[model samples]
Target: MSPGLKFIDFSIMPVLLGAGSCRRFLKTRMLRKMTIKHYSSNRRSNSPDNQYSTIAEIKEKMMKSFGLEPGYTTEPKSREELLKYQPKFEDLPARSMQDSFSSAIIPLSTDAVLQDKYINFRGFARLGRLLEDMDLFAAWCCHRHLKVPNLPEGVPLPYSIVTVLVDRIDFTSVSPNGTQDIRLSGHVSWVGSSSMEVVVWLEQVVNEEYQKITRALFLMAARNATNTAAAPVNPIQPANEEEKVILAGGADRKKQRQILSAQSVFKVEPNAEEQSLIYQLYKRTTPVEQTGQQRLLPPNCIWMHDSFQMSTIPSFPEHRNQNNTVFGGFLMRSALEISWATAFLYCKARPQLEHISDISFQKPVSVNSFIKMTAYVVYTKENYLQIMTVAEVLDAYTGSRVTTNAFHYTFSAPDPVTEVLPRSYHDTMWYINGRRKFKASRG
Candidate 1:
């Protein structure tokens, strides 16, 4: 599309999934460089004496090509006016769930609260993190209550909340007559739910130059006490790693619109062709609770243990530098794709169950390595089922393990199309298989 046509490309970041992390989206494609031929026929009217450049320069040019204004600008602020616009969201008092069931609402923070200078970021990225927080809270709640059992070797929980949007925002900052208190105030309205949307707003203020964030609202989705089917595996917090980029001026990752509504849950179905592909991976990786400790088939089946796609592959060549690993949701999305694909292969009666917060990444897959992955059936309840994923990073040449991790996925009932297909060869047989492919490095 031409720049004058649509501006949607100006926004939205395509998700890039690494082994265990989800990085933000770049403005343009991450493939081979994009080159544009800026042709001007009239030499006198158009400056014709331009220079030719490499594809790298073309990428930079593309950054400026689309008729878009630069997002960040630094108009020199007057020392007097620097105190304004310090905080984007103001703090408000929070209502408790006790108030909710009672049909009462309470605010969390107040006008006197303050804000600090925080890690600076634009809109989409900020909302993306808020969503991640939502996922963390949901997972914690699930883990505390629901626990899926008979786990095949190597699988763990990776349940998380996906960021959808910033429903509301309010900013409060001011410059008093002659005072010198640079302050910040605001609140973020967040919607949390799988199908039934539960919305909450958090009030926050800056302190001490914005180095820390103190919660003015502590909230979580209500647990389904009636459905005591399994123990919940998710906790109400983000992963325990704190990192910062040295030069962190990267574009935002993404703030996708919520596709699955708040009331929805994951469903699964089995098919033949999908069985063949995954049957090659998950035939014999069943859980073995030998000597009271749970393990994989072949007793300690590493083959079935390292088949999930939660890790990255290092480069085969010496010079290649692309290593894709970031946030956990990207990996979960990939696993869901594979889970559905694998379910079609072996399932006869039920689709598959996709339980959350049961995935664990135990190792880091470095740049340029081959990946080994596997999946297997653990157990079933009614039509809801659970499968295990074992993912590992490996040396392409020596076949040595580089990193290993595991996860458990849930699938639901079969669909109409799945009911029609005859059982594939993989439906009856089982074995844990793994493979890898070679491709050129990403530019």
Candidate 2:
């Protein structure tokens, strides 16, 4: 038996339900009774038994309840047919923040079976699964905020929502108990003509009070039905003083992102301070008596090239989303797992995840493709280790690869970790980038 199979007891035949059986139960009973109104508030209630429902299941039911379906243009045979369904930005009306507000509940406390699905081997709720939930929930909120006008009956929604970037995910409290109920709530905090910023909160119910565990900021783009062009989304205006502050924060984050992009190492040379730092690192790692020999590594230090871990994964259909591509959440989970492993190998001990930030989804991974993830320990300060993981999709025919995503994670080790030194100019840039992220995450 597989190690994970130990969590399940085959002796309890009634508790073990097949996928078809679970789907039937959800469709017949849960889907028929649950509605968005039931989940509009954060207060716990004697709601119907929905402990078996996943985020995807809940999203599907909610969309159907609202008389909406996955937005796709009917087999556009030509360019003219596709252009006919192109979305118009001028027609979309401005909306208030309250209009897009939403909430969801994962009743892990009441459902042992559901808890089993989210619990990790260490007994904490899996952060990757939570990430998947956040991505789906953010898209759901965006759909709620969108208001496309004048569509005929039986026609699907005229917009396709896609996650473009995860600006930051901060964990205020790590180690969420697997047996506790979790609440997810958020809204469209800011919006442009074609893009929107969603802020989602993950909280665990402790003593009947919701305690925040993680707060995530996701950037999503709206596209036309066929996802060929950008689609305009309803603008969001602040309804209260607090909301105004939130909106301003979003604008600041947008501006900050622009600044960072313009200052990327690939775009320009490093400033004097950064150059000085890189030279210092080079000197420290170089041998004083150079006889055309490799420098001896100092005690408690390892080269960044030596601190890498890699894995290859086949993009299975089960991980695909409505867009017929690999789900963003699945990619995030895989990256986290590999990064965690990289940190473990570098530290020679288990490391506790401090936070995750700047997870960028550069491209979509197609089903049946293979993903190659490479993780390296690029920086270490005191007991903190920063791991950077890059995910790329490989072309089977040409044997070339295109990067799909990049992930940065900060973990705390039990003891001071061995220092990771840069060996080349390329590795030096990664080291500097990691240092910047580590400092920002700490602040």
What TM-score, over all chains together, does every model reach?
A: 0.27, 0.84
Tell me the whole-model lDDT of each prediction, alpha carbons only.
0.28, 0.76
User: Candidate 2: which stretches are off by over 4 Å?
Assistant: 1-54, 62-86, 289-293
lDDT for model 2, on a 0 to 1 scale?
Answer: 0.76
* Model 2: per-residue Cα lDDT over 241-328, one tens digit each: 4556667777888999999989877688888999999878767777896666465677789989999999999987677665667889
Q: Write one digit per residue (lDDT tens) for candidate 1, span 1-443.
A: 12322234523433333311221111112100111222333334331112223222332332232111323223311222212211111121222211121001111122122111111122111222322333333222222222223333333221222222122111123111111211111111121232112222222223312211211121223222211111122111211111112011110111222222221122232345545645533344334333533323443222322322233333333211111223333334444445655555545443433233224445444434465555554433344444555566666677677435554454556642211111233332222111100000000
Mark the 10 consecutive residues where model 2 has the least summed lDDT: 23-32
**Best candidate, TM-score:** 2
Stretches off by above 4 angstroms in model 1 are 1-327, 348-354, 415-443
Each prediction's number of clashing residue pairs = 98, 0
- Model 2, residue pairs in steric clash: none
